[model samples]
Target: MTTDHLLYLCFWCFRSIFSVITFSFTSSVFAQQFDQQYLIWKQQQNAHDLRLESTLTHQSAEAVISKKLEPKQALATTGLSTASERVNINQANVQQLQKLKGVGEKKALAIIEYRQQYGSFKHIEQLKQVKGIGESIFLKNQTQLAL
Candidate 1:
C-alpha cells in the first residue's frame, strides 16, 4: 500500500476503537443508574408491603378486643378512657396513671417511682415535678386530678 493509504487506514482503526470505548462507557453508566433506580423501587415496594402488614395486625388485635369487652368498659380498660373520670394522684395506682392522657407505660412507671420516693402528692401541681410531665401535660390532666 502507498504511505497515504496506510495513514488513512490507521486513522480509521483508531476512530473505530475510540467510538467503541465511548459507547461501552456510556452503556455502563446507564446500566448503573438503572440498577440504582430498580433498587430504590424495590425498597419502596417493601416498605409499602410492611405498612399493609402492620395495618392487618392492628385490625386483628382490635377484632379480638371488641369481642372481649363491652364498648364502654373496653374503652377505659384499653387506655382510651374519657377525661371526665377523676384520678386522685395520691390514691391512684399504676393502672390509673396509665389511663391519663400522654401517660404511657414509662410515664406511669415514673409516676409510681416518684410517689414511692417522695411522700404522697399534697397538691395537683406536684405532678409537674415528675420526669416527662412538663407544664402542658400537667395542665391537660389538671381538670381530672383531685387531692
Candidate 2:
C-alpha cells in the first residue's frame, strides 16, 4: 500500500480501538453512577432509560465522563448527600436548593420565591419558569427531579 494509504488504515484502526474503549470506560463510570441515579430515576423515572441505558458509546469517553460528573460536583462539595441526589424544588429549603448544579444563594432564593408565588410546583418541568433556570439546567437534572 502507498504510505498515505497505510497511514489511513492505521488511523482507522486506532479510531476503532478508541471507540471500543470508550464504551468500556464509560460503562464502568456509568455503573458507578448507576446505583446513584437509580433511586432518583425511580421517582422521576420515564421511558427515558429507567433501565439505565447510556448514550456514551456515541460520544468521546472524556466528554461522556465530564458531562456525567459535572452535575454531581456541587452535591459532592456539600458532603451531605449522595452524588446523584437532587433537590426537590417544591420542598427544598434554601440549603437544599443551593446544593444543585448551578444554583447559588440568589438563585436558591429565586426558586423559593417562585415556589411561594406559584404554590407547589405542578411538575419538575415548571422549574424552567424560575428566574435563572432554563431548558439547559432543567435538562441537566432530569433524573434528579420529582413531581
Candidate 3:
C-alpha cells in the first residue's frame, strides 16, 4: 500500500475508536445519573409511606382509647351529660344552664337575665332571644332544651 493510503486508513481507525470511547463514557455518565435520580425518588416514597403509617397508627390509637372509655366518661369528654336528661332553661340555675352545649358561665348568666327581664321563655324558640344565644347555639341545644 502507498504511504498516504496507509496514513489515511490509520486516521480513520483512530477516529472510529475515539468516537466509540466517547460514546461509552457518555452512556456510563447517563446511567449513573439515572440511578441517582431513582434512589432519590425511592427515598422520598419511603418517607411518605412512613408518614402515612404514623397517621394511621395515631388514628387507630384514638379509636382504641375511645372504645375503652365508659359511657359516662365518653359523655363527659364531649362536654355533655345523658341526652335524655335535658335542661329546663326557664328554671335552670347558671350551673345547670351551662350543661347545654356552648353555654358557658357568661352565656348562662345572659340567659338568666333575659329570662328574668322577659318573664320566662314562652316557647323553646324564645331562648334564642338571649344576648349570646344565636341561631347556632340555639340549634346545638335544641334537642336538650325544655320549656
Clashes of each: 0, 0, 0
lDDT (Cα, 0-100) at 123 in candidate 3? 94
The window of 10 residues in a row where model 1 has the poorest summed lDDT is 72-81
Order of candidate numbers by lDDT, starting with the best: 3, 1, 2
Q: Which candidate order results from sorting by TM-score in descending order?
A: 1, 3, 2
Query: What C-alpha lDDT do the candidate models reach, one value each?
Result: 0.83, 0.74, 0.85
Per-model TM values vs. the true structure: 0.48, 0.45, 0.47
Q: Write the per-residue lDDT of candidate 1 for residues 1-147, one digit (tens) a residue.
A: 999999999999999999999999999999999999999999999999999877765655675576775555545554555656788888788888877788888988898889999989989999999999999989888898887
Candidate 2 has which clashing residue pairs, if any?
A: none
* Model 3: per-residue Cα lDDT over 68-120, one tens digit each: 86655555445447878788888999988988888899999999999888798
Model 2 residue 118 lDDT score: 82
Q: Give the TM-score of candidate 2.
A: 0.45
Q: Is candidate 1 or candidate 2 better by TM-score?
A: 1
lDDT of 3: 0.85
